[model samples]
Target: MAGFRYEEVAGSIAGQVEAGVYGPGDRLPGVRKLARQFGVSVSTVVAAQHLLEDRGVIEARPRSGYYVRLRPQRPPQAPERTRPEGQPTQVTGQALVLRVVQAANEPDTVQLGAAVPHAEFLPTHGLQRAFSGVPRRYPGRATDYLFPPGPVELRQQIARRMADAGCRLSPEEIVVTNGAQEALVLSLRAVAEPGDVVAIESPTFYGLLQAIEGQGMRALEIPTDPDEGISPEALALALEQWPVAAAMLMPNFGNPLGHRASEGRKREVVALLEERGVPLIEDDVYGDLAFEAPRPWAAKAYEDRGGVLYCGSFSKTLSPGLRVGWAAPGRFRDRLEYLKYAASAATPAFPGFAAADFLARGGYDRYLRRVRGEYARAVARVRRAVARYFPEGTRQTDPEGGFVLWVELPAEVDSLALYQAALAEGISIAPGPMFSPTQRFRNFLRLNCAQPWNGNFERALRRIGELARERSG
Candidate 1:
């Protein structure tokens, strides 16, 4: 440690790169300067530079000094790929999801936040196998774009799969989009116009809020429950008091709250909406991820008139990177399809074909079964951890499926402050205010239970609890 040589200096520099102290393309100190810093010969510094370059960690330019390559600085194993450059689109609701992921993935962050699945549990190799088989079957079509409604095979599969949930649909009923996010957006554009009053769950997916905001529409929050999703009585009350053009909801595994509105209640609500002549946009992105018995069908299943626009995606089940999702607009299918064309002209081709092949290979059901089992176990662990570490009287909503857990902390605890403090401790969580219309759930926080039981996650949860107790006291 007293008089370090070349290997030590090189090791130290590599550690800095791994720690993100030097970013991609950042130049390293000159070899002579490094030699002096390490009190080593220039030859040793040169050898270290050569070693780093050989390892594909860095590269040297002809005239310039050595620079950190983008490849080497990245973790040898990242949880999942992330696109960091996308600007905060004026597009609604995107920021809410992004904010949660951003907080979780930050360096050294304790990720008690964000609904991301554990990296180790993901079926990456299965997806790769699915990808490989795509080109072998259709060498020419694999690279070609499937404009608008996406691949026919994938759409057909979706239509067929809808039967499991008690919904009857022809392939024409389905329109593929990038993800459920797009499905929600397309439904919003198709049914509601600018300045229309769009009723939403009081504490809804913030992304949906952003979508409504982007369309220049007004949002009316109906009081909702943590266990049963939107309160039917509350929605009926809002409909009576206000002239709502359209309503959006997550009837199954509602984000933030993880509530699954009962079938009886869903039917009642659907009937009421029909009587009021208002359309409903049902976001069911997590419907298939249910860990309990066969999940409930869409509220649209009961409607004869197709007043419900049902949107879902394989992003949670298969692969998020594929960005494959679909919509069944009970009455507005044509409008939703056309809107899909106008938005992106077309969904990417390979991903659609690959997804279709993946499902057709008889792997889809197997994957879901495995995912549900793993997630259920992880959820149990998460529940036990919360019950043990969180304060007494702190309530939690138990989701039948999906990876999100919403915790209600003491009223005195400001989740915004807790979020900020948790970030400093290298942990990330979604603040309660982001999910509400009037930010009414300021004392709440949403944690991602998708992460497995690990020391890093456990410590982060404890830290978050400590902070909450301090603030509450």
Candidate 2:
């Protein structure tokens, strides 16, 4: 307890800095002074100072005392609430989405497009070692076909991890898929039939749109708030007007928008869907990456009626190359299992075994702690860069979790053209229109903030800002 006392002291100091009581660049109290002030020993105060320094909250000069570290100015105002017309529209933009995906994968381009974590932050060596041992661990696993529900050990580990997100899941309810994409596709197929209307958040992930289109379903864009996610009122109105089959949403740290629906909003949405007997598919890929302490609760945590289908994957937190994703399909378990069998036959066994071993050995949570801190710092740096580089009147999202920022540029700038220009300059960005089924955000774009800050990344931001100015003119 004494050893951990410094964390409390550091937190007190961090609170002071956040409250502006200790302004940036202001020297903190001397160790002796702080010891006296907090009724702790001088050694404890020194530990507290070291902790603060490690968190980037304070710095130590060679001869001087610790001082609050200067950070980038507060980010520009978040974009306004989205106003998507409550109309069921056929999903398009597959061609543009394909082009952007191709460009994002180019080796020479600066990757600011795809919502993927950089490999440097991942546990590459540990995962490789785990993979190497998989064959020996399960002699025939490499050559065998894992059934629809996947490896028992992986599902068991996933069920244990789900407890952190406030969901009490069982290994039996979980079904493994190629990735979250496959999980999402299976959930969609299990719930809604072809030609049925499914409601989704406006400015949602492009991959969701692709999934909906692939299922031959129409998308009903709901008005979504930048901070609170989809509007419950808009969703209720849409439900009243249309014969909605099901709803898909990212209730915890949604992609593109990076908004988390409030628990109350989640309850309201869930209640409405339950009342209407509609299935709710929740994309929780970013749930474990919360920037702050105490990870936020998932939408499925409030589901008492088993109407929520919870989908998650290690792609965002762990290695995407593993392609290990799973879903707790609640009431739709049988249908989803059937869909998984029909779609891909079965998920590969090697990655599931590797991921399961990684989780069982407790490496996953430790890696999450490291990457969560990195992502928080990286998001702050990216926001500051956007504030400095982008044209005037540009707005961006301040995400609570996850590694993506949604930027709304000046109306005069066409984000598609900006995407082209950025690509030509060996940079990749996800244009705004790609996120919507109707291609609505012509002047918007999304940036990936997972990569560590570097000179090349800075140069890319500067170039994008210059291009934004040119396009505005």
Candidate 3:
């Protein structure tokens, strides 16, 4: 515990900087004096300052004290909250989605399009170690069909983790699946029938739109705030007007927009839907990736009557290749379990066992802490570059967590054209239209900030900015 005093010192100084105690280019007091002030050793102050430097909060000068790092110029205006007319529509734009995915796969391209974290940021060796032990630990169980409920070890791990999201579920309540996508699929099927309407956040993750389309359901786009999440007032109006069977929401660091709804907002939306006899399929795949400590709660956390079907996956935080995911459907537990059996049966056994192994051994919590900090720095780096390089009038989301940054380009610029131009330069960007069922958000785009920050990455972003400027011209 004495070793952690430096972290406390660093946090206190960072808080001071955040509170404007030190301005850009402002010098920090010499190491010894600060140590005296904080009641820590000079060595502790040095350690804390080293951490601040790594966090990009301060810079060390030759024979001079550290100064707060000068930040890039920010856009003067805030991004407008989306106000999609609450109308149910059939989803399209899967073609564009495919093209973006393909571009992301190109070996020579800068991967700033897909939301996948950079392979370097993932715990590749740790996961490999976890995977290698599956056979020895689980015996012949690793080779057999895991069945619907999956291996108890994995289900128990998931149930334990779900408690952080405010759900006290048994392993029996969890149904393992291929990924969050499959979990979403099963949740959607369990709650709604074909031809039903599913309310969703406007400018939502494209995958959600595709899932709604695949289910033969219509998506009613509700006005969503990039900071707060789907508007409850708009949702209430939509529910009153439409014959909605279910509502799919991502209250915890949602995709593309990267917004985390507040706990009060989550409770409000949950109660609103539960009272209307509507089911909420809560996609919380990115919940654990919050930049700050003490991860946020899920909308499912606020509901008790089985109205909220919670879906999550390790694909985003852990290993996507493992394809480990699960759903806690509460009252719809039986329905979702049967649907999982009918749709994909049991998922691959080794992945579940390996994932459970890693989680049980206490490797995941450590990785979560490291990965969250990595992503926070990466997101801030990309945000600074976008603000400094992009044309005036461009606004982007300041995400609370997750690796995605959604940019709202100038109205004169078409993000589709920008995407094509960036692709030609061996860079990939997610055009705005794909995030919508009706192909809206033509002037918007989302960028992946999980890539390691380097000259190549910065060059790619600058070139994308050039492309946007050309389009606007």
Misplaced by over 4 Å in model 1 are 1-97, 104-107
Better of 1 and 3 by lDDT: 3
Show where candidate 3 strays beyond 4 Å: 1-76
Candidate 3 global TM-score:
0.87
Local distance difference test values of all predictions, in order:
0.77, 0.88, 0.87
Q: Which window of ten consecutive residues has the lowest lDDT sum in model 1?
A: 78-87
- Quick one: how many clashes does candidate 1 have? 7
lDDT of 2 by residue, 5-85 (tens): 999898898878765567545688888999998999999898998888887888888898897665413454888888988
278-384 in candidate 1: lDDT tens per residue? 99999988888776557678787878789999999987777767789899998798888889988988888778888888788888888777777667556656666
- lDDT, residue 331, model 1: 78
Residue-level lDDT for 245 in candidate 1: 90
Predicted candidate 3 versus true structure: per-residue lDDT over 39-88, tens digit per residue: 98999999999999988888898988897765312336656789887789
- Please state every model's RMSD to the true fold in angstroms: 17.3, 6.6, 6.9
